[model samples]
Target: MCRTSILPSTVKAVKRGEAGSAGELRGDFDLSGDLGPLYANTGSGIFGRLEEAPRAGAAVPVGMALPGPATILANVRGDEVREYDIEILKVAPSSADGRDLVLSVTDPELLEETGGIVQGMSGSPILQNGKLVGAVTHVLLNNPEKGYGILIDHMLEAAGDGVD
Candidate 1:
């Protein structure tokens, strides 16, 4: 689960629906998960065992994250997941609260469509060099184009799933 105040007993994720812009909800999902405290919930992200796991992707060390070209997989509108271009502006490997990747949205289509980063885009995968590096965590309210991301390493560490 992404960072949110309300943790309901059940979470209904988006599966299929019409696309939407900022401040609007889109998509639909029949898949739902039952909440339990056994899951690892931390400042970085939430991790839990699913009945059927999704295929695992290549993982990259967070230390490799730098100021360079990258892409974020996000479902900003409807159920269509698209890869949006982004620039890794800065990296804080030592960040304690998961604000490791400082990035900006540069994709013209994403910028024009959703007006940069908006709500419900958190936990979007940040991929670089064909590897998973981090996840979008928060967006700059004053400048939606800018935002912070949590390093995948940090998330894995928080979940006690791996070690350096």
Candidate 2:
């Protein structure tokens, strides 16, 4: 029963237009005692059930910790996946209703280039300790230098059901 909130409107849209898909709604059934695949993608927890499973690519494992040094892969300029250094300012545990990870863009070059997190970089992969921890889900417009990230576990759980 994975769920998430505190997402920007852009990040919460049903881009896939599939059933059981919502802006912030993802699935994660990988927890102990759970028997089904989860439908995840939003900024939440582990995998869940779904139909069209995405091709499992190189992502960090589920249940990874946060509030550490990290890197994010974002296609900010054209098709190139550029890397940016960041810091996980905070980790909003499940009790925080899926607040997930807060971030501070520490890459001076990226700031000079993009001016901060953009609208289209919502799905950018956040890597900590060389592991895929989550994705960029929101931006603090008042302070573009700061933003939020969703746990990679939630993505795994959502894609777990076999959907992209």
Candidate 3:
């Protein structure tokens, strides 16, 4: 049997307004790196075991992801991870599959460069207060500046991390 990843080999890379051959706003994506074996695709996000050790970081509780200021680490440009400012607009504690945070891009530079959330940014980590909170999930089709995020807690749960 052939196994495949939740995310396709070709990442979605394009601005929303950019038209395709059929006059449709289709996006394209480039494969930057490998994420190893992804075990879960909760619809909101994907969870996987990495091939290499990850950087040191702290994992905060989902409750910490309140409506407030946050930042997302993304690589809009080739391999260069940059932190962009954002705001947590709302928290849906009861949401299933990790769509627990609503966020909007507030960084002037990010907005000017990517024109809000484009393709190839689905799994960018959303951080707040120097801790990992959630990840960017789906972008608002009408307004690229706004998007949904999956709480880190949900992701951890889906990954079978803490269950006894």
The lDDT per prediction is 0.70, 0.61, 0.70
For every model in order, what is the number of clashing pairs?
Answer: 3, 26, 4
TM-score of each: 0.72, 0.61, 0.73
Which residue pairs clash within candidate 3?
Answer: 11-29, 12-28, 13-28, 13-29
Assess candidate 1 and give its TM-score to the true structure.
0.72
Per-residue lDDT, model 1, residue 161, is 51
Candidate with best TM-score: 3
Which lDDT tens digits does candidate 1 get at residues 1-164?
55322222222243221224233234444335433234666798866654443445444445457789999998765446789999999999887676898989999987777667666777888988878889988777667788899888788778885232
lDDT of 2 by residue, 88-130 (tens): 9998756243448889889988776655676666778888777
Task: Indicate the residue-level lDDT of 154 in model 3.
Answer: 73
1 or 2, greater by lDDT: 1
- Consecutive 10-residue window with the lowest summed lDDT within model 2: 8-17
RMSDs, each prediction? 6.4, 11.2, 4.9
How much is 138 displaced in model 1, in angstroms? 0.5
lDDT of 3: 0.70
